[model samples]
Target: MAQAEGTYDEAQIRAEYADLTRELIARGLQVSTMESATSGQIASLITDTEGASAVLRGAYVTYCNEAKVKCGVPAEVIRAHTVYSTQTAEAMARACRRSYAANIGIGVTGTMGNVDSANPAASTPGEVYFAICTGAGSDARGEKNHSFHVHLAPQPSRLMYKLAVAKEVRDRLVVLLAEAAA
Candidate 1:
């Protein structure tokens, strides 16, 4: 199989970002993100389009366990489910929403190769976990609303994986927002 050095669909991402920002602005909703494996690529993509400031509250690049915990991911959850699991991702999402007072919060965590030997909770290379939360309670702990889990087996280049994950996150956010709008 051919390996893509970097295969981000900029046009598609731009369209999605435009639509997402428009809908959020229309509804007076704010969005934020907690990113790990993909670093801040998700937030970067969202902020790339115009009018993003209206809906984007900023993001936390919680690529480390400490950062994730500091941002609102429970330490116990990480211990129990590992930082790469859905549980941690959900917690991260909820925390972002609460901390940023955003209507929508997205958490993305996974291993993008060069796994940290110190973290036994790290997942297989290219395995990613995502959670999108909404209507988070006033409590800083927050609540989980939605989740997406996937593994890009035979993972492409690190850059390709990040782009793929960003695209997935964007696509999922669009669908969730559309559902809420209905």
Candidate 2:
């Protein structure tokens, strides 16, 4: 992909989002999202595409622990593990599916706070986790994909990092949706 001459490669990101949206609708699936750290960037990108309403259900920009709970994420789950863990992502995906009645639900969380050397795990500023919930029955199954410790250099700035993460999430979802359809 040719890099756009801007802070973010908006053209590339939009192209990927369009493809993902097309594939999701073609597969007769709908999607919703619950997000943190990346804020609502992922949700915004999905909705920005035309015909998104056909397969894009809704999104919860649950940037706070309280918001996550209000959005249907179980309190016990968040209490057991902080919002940055894989388990939290799974819970968010499951909750999004139930709340929005979507065929696929995406949950994303990451760290963007001050990095503390004392807490090595919190050092990475762009670590993200994504979960995709599938199936229709009450006992729906979902899969979790982690970006692990993505350490974006300081030059990109926080907004750029978030945009990059949104693009990555969209690209990954496209692959997963295609695989599921196959």
Q: Each model's C-alpha lDDT? A: 0.79, 0.70
Error (Å) of candidate 2 at residue 126 is: 2.0
**Top candidate when judged by TM-score against the true structure:** 1
Over 1-182, each residue of candidate 1 has an lDDT whose tens digit, in order, gives: 11223456667766777777777788888888999888888788777777889888879999789999888888999998898888898998888988888888899987765566767546676677899998844554545479888765444577667778877777788788778778
Question: Model 1, poorest ten-residue lDDT window?
Answer: 1-10
The alpha-carbon deviation from the true structure for residue 130 of candidate 2, after best TM-score superposition, in angstroms, is 1.8
Can you tell me which runs of candidate 1 are displaced by over 4 Å?
1-8, 140-144, 154-156
RMSD per candidate (Å) reads 3.9, 4.8
TM-score of 1: 0.85
lDDT against true structure, model 2: 0.70
TM-score of each: 0.85, 0.80
**Candidate 1 lDDT (Cα, 0 to 1):** 0.79
| Per-residue lDDT over 6-66 for candidate 2, one digit per residue giving the tens place of the 0 to 100 score | 3457677777777777777677788888987778887787777778889878899987789
* Top-scoring candidate (lDDT): 1
